[model samples]
Target: MDNTTLVDNANVVATPNGVLPLAASVELVCSSRTFVPFLFVFCAIYHFLAPLYTTPKQLSWILTTVASATMTLVSIPFVWDYVSSGGDVKSVRTLSSLTYATTRMFQAYLVSDLIMGSIYYRNQLMLLTGWFHHILYVFIVQICIKRAWTQIFCLCALMELPTFLLAISCLYPRLRSNVAFAVTFFLTRILLHLIWCISYLIPSNRTHTTGGSILPSVMLAGVFPLHAIWFKGCVKGFIKRRKENRALAPQAVTVDAVALAHATIPSSTSDSYISFRSASHNHPARKDYSLSTLHHIGYRLWPARKAIYSFVGLGRQTSS
Candidate 1:
């Protein structure tokens, strides 16, 4: 860490060698606007490339890829440095250029995901934790930055290692390693998270936790159930997708070029009927409306005469 200077009443340290001030990263990310938009653009590009995956699944995978890569990258180094340096010099206020940048990136990613996920997973979204968890995470991370709990923030980010491993397995089943995913999941989310919630038992290490004492305990303890719920969802999704692929292997895809165009029919007097946009998709299609878009439009038009086009031999099974 470099010599700390009181700049704007916030501790400022020289870059590359010293601690990077939290305010600087936040300002760089917030004021420039391009920093966060680039993240969103990255997801958009991934969505374009991953045509085989379903809408929600593509979005989910995109976020997981970026997050797991960023969080794990920053966290491993922090943990290694602290452990190797004998841990005597490390402090709660020790913010790294990489860690703060990571935290800010995470904050921006969550915010962008809230907008994008709400659109894709809006109706099917969980009131419990699907999008709400993102909101809560943004808050907790903000608190970590505000309080300068850099080390605790790094550890909390490390807990996502399990999610990332499973995500890789899902993205590429040919390279799937359930054993590695399970070990990391249990070690990080189950064991390490539980340890964080109970760290108060060790008075010496208790102070190292963010929020002094109560908040870290309460936040992660409360978050344990969420981890269980989400983990179960991920497992079910993985298994279901595997079974789907197996079933799809023997079948043949049927495609058709039917005349279809965008339309806007009035639903209510308030003019809520907007254009039902159709875009190119990977799966077989009946004209412009592919299976996925068909599903989307059907979802958009609930109960009020759903567009059920029974194209013969299309063989529809939703893929993730």
Candidate 2:
């Protein structure tokens, strides 16, 4: 019986199936194990270099830009094929040669950035979703490397392209005031991820063996809903900011109009204008004693006087 079992196992192993052989699997695992120490060393070097940046924000922006450039360059071929094939997963090519090395390097950057971000902004880092995302990503990449799922990994990495823009929006305060960043974020991070999960990952999991593709599919499935929630928040925030800007538009226009009015004052009133401006600047405290200030003070005191009268009446009634 033992001999029969051994022979059957040997036949299964020798079969020219698409699955990796045991020796190849072991080698891949060993390579992954060896690569982890290098990743740690790189992260350590990045941490030590953090002091070179003037501010934490600058360091974050620089790291994000570097990571974005690396991933964008490496995943371009995969992205092109995916798009050209009309979003067909089968059309996507696996990473190879320099591209594979670049992808690995980008992953190292992600890990290092996460570690450094946590160290520098420990409090704010806890409030961000990125901490969990980065932790999950490291595990996902390790799994993809071990299973040789380079195409799927590339698809996943492509999400970082929009993330680069998101980082840019954070770096440039002006970008945050518009809807462009939010729209791009929704399209790339939320919409693309949703499509990938529904069209590619789910279908692949259904057709492929559990050993090769299940973990990645499951991980993506678990992450998709979170992205959906984040997208909803982004939409709401965009609307809120738009409303705020609109509300402030009139106030800004009024200020501009007042400045124009002041500029158009006749030359004959130059002396009066100069005296007014000098008094306003030199005696700011005295300028607060205006009709508007008095009106506001009266409005506040009215409520207090009513409360005091009510309290005195209640006290007299209780004593009687």
Per-residue accuracy of model 2 over 175-204 as CA lDDT, tens digit each: 653466567667777777777766555555
Runs with alpha carbons beyond 4 Å of true place in candidate 1: 1-56, 81-93, 120-125, 208-211, 230-320
On the 0 to 100 scale, the lDDT of residue 274 in model 2 is 55
Local distance difference test, per candidate? 0.61, 0.60
C-alpha root-mean-square deviation, candidate 1: 17.8
Question: Model 1 misses residue 175 by how many Å?
Answer: 2.8
lDDT of 1 by residue, 1-320 (tens): 43554444465544555556767755644535744665666567556755667656545566667677778877776666545756532333355565566677777777766665666656545666557777888888887666666567786677778767766666666767766776777777877778666763355656554424566667778789978776676678679888996675434222222222233444542233232323233233334345785665545433233222212233354699
Q: Candidate 2: worst 10 consecutive residues by lDDT?
A: 1-10
Question: Residue 134, candidate 1: how far off, in angstroms?
Answer: 0.9
The C-alpha stretches of model 2 lying farther than 4 A from their native spots are: 1-53, 97-103, 172-177, 201-214, 264-320
The residue-level lDDT of candidate 1 at 183 comes to 72
